[model samples]
Target: MLVTAEGAVRIWTINLPKAGNAITGADFIAAFEAAVDAANRDTGVCAVVLTGAGKIFSAGGNVREMADRKGMFGLPAIEQRYAYVDGIQRIPRALARLEVPLIAAVNGPAIGAGCDLAMMCDIRVASERATFAESFVTLGLVPGDGGTWFLQRAIGYERAAELTFTGKTLDAATARNWGLVSRVVPHEELMPTALELAGQIAENPPRALRMAKRLLQESRTGALESTLGMAAAMQPLAHHDDEHDRRIAKWRSA
Candidate 1:
């Protein structure tokens, strides 16, 4: 299932089980962008949750695909291969632009691109069995996509470097300690907890929530003054909405 919906959260499950549920080619990116667009267009959807169906979260790219002799031998084949890799890598940035909040429900192992995908989300709730690693270097590749950017921001530059350089595996507890995942719950409780969290977010005013997400995302590359201006500019628009008025009236009456 590339995308599934439950209540207010649209779940995107990585579906390439042929390679141990790995995301291989351009099709994965196309599917993801479509899912984000669908979720964004739905008035009922207030958030998105990304997870892996079945057992493994994802095993990054298909190792066999990357090691194809045809692709390595010719310029055209190499270019085609690169295009495919590029599309796969762009999934994180496409996900980053989604209007609503994204929560990663890390049910199991997330290595390489799988790990990067989880980190790209605004929040991550991991199962006890979940594990993360930056195993790209072990495969003789650097962290592609937004992994370096997100990881550095997530766990600081030094730690990100260590993880990238050493290709070390991090368990749920260690990941939580380094601020990779926001919370860790028992395996059975993972989906419920993530859904509950998504439901809570859904209860908020949708426009305001999306605007807040935009501001936070923009803040990453936005200038400080511009961010401040944006926040200041957005307040009146959000505060004057009917949802705000009703919620405030309820609070005032209380």
Candidate 2:
């Protein structure tokens, strides 16, 4: 795992290209969550850009571990369920608690859990070479890592169901057509495009940016009055922020 900063956008590269960038085990989960926590602690960060170092963004779970029955794919259905809870499942939980927005830069193949990881982000951008698949069915398994919940929300229920059921692969253009990704760029332009978008988001007042994201999440499942109530509470805090004053002054001068 490697993390770098470009302005207020923190870029996270899943560095295990040799292993196809598979999010292999509990150690990887702990490192990933720890990185997320670090980003949350930094108020200066307004967005995070997650991508992979090599051709594959992530191959998802470790198939080797599954074959060996050693890691998260441990034997016994009950232990396997608990293993998911104590392992890969913690990632989505940590992401849900993230203070800033997350942007997925799908550099290449994002299969199975990798696709679900992208769906967890606030926004998604794709490289022309990017591919996506909800492939748990191919392995005779299910999306135990919140894929069912997040994938449906990203696209629609029908589209998500089709992908999950058949384990179909979607190209970047098709992904955009299905509203799975915001846009697709040349593979070489992927990071630049994602960073430009992140820069636009990162320039806003830090506190307000986070609060606005919270309101967006609230509006997803909450009532209209509930979203409004959160906005009402957040507005006062935004008004008191130094960035608010500076922005106002800058606008006045302009």
Per-model TM-score versus the true fold: 0.92, 0.97
Q: Give all candidates' CA lDDT scores.
A: 0.83, 0.91
Residue 145's lDDT in candidate 2: 92
Q: How close is candidate 2 to the true structure, as a TM-score?
A: 0.97
Global CA lDDT computed for model 1: 0.83
What tens digits encode model 1's per-residue C-alpha lDDT throughout 1-254?
47777877787788766665676455667778888878778767898888887777877767776777433223575685676456666687577768999999998889988888787889999998999999999989877666898888888999999999999999999999999999999999998899999999999988899899999998988999999999999999998989899999999999
Residue runs of model 1 more than 4 Å from their true location after superposition: 70-86
Deviation from native of the Cα of residue 103 in model 1, angstroms: 0.5
Candidate 1 least-lDDT 10 residues: 69-78
Structure candidate 2, residue pairs in collision: none
Q: The CA-based lDDT of model 2 is what?
A: 0.91
Please write out the lDDT profile of model 2 over residues 61-107, one tens digit for every residue.
98887888776566688987788898889999999888898999999
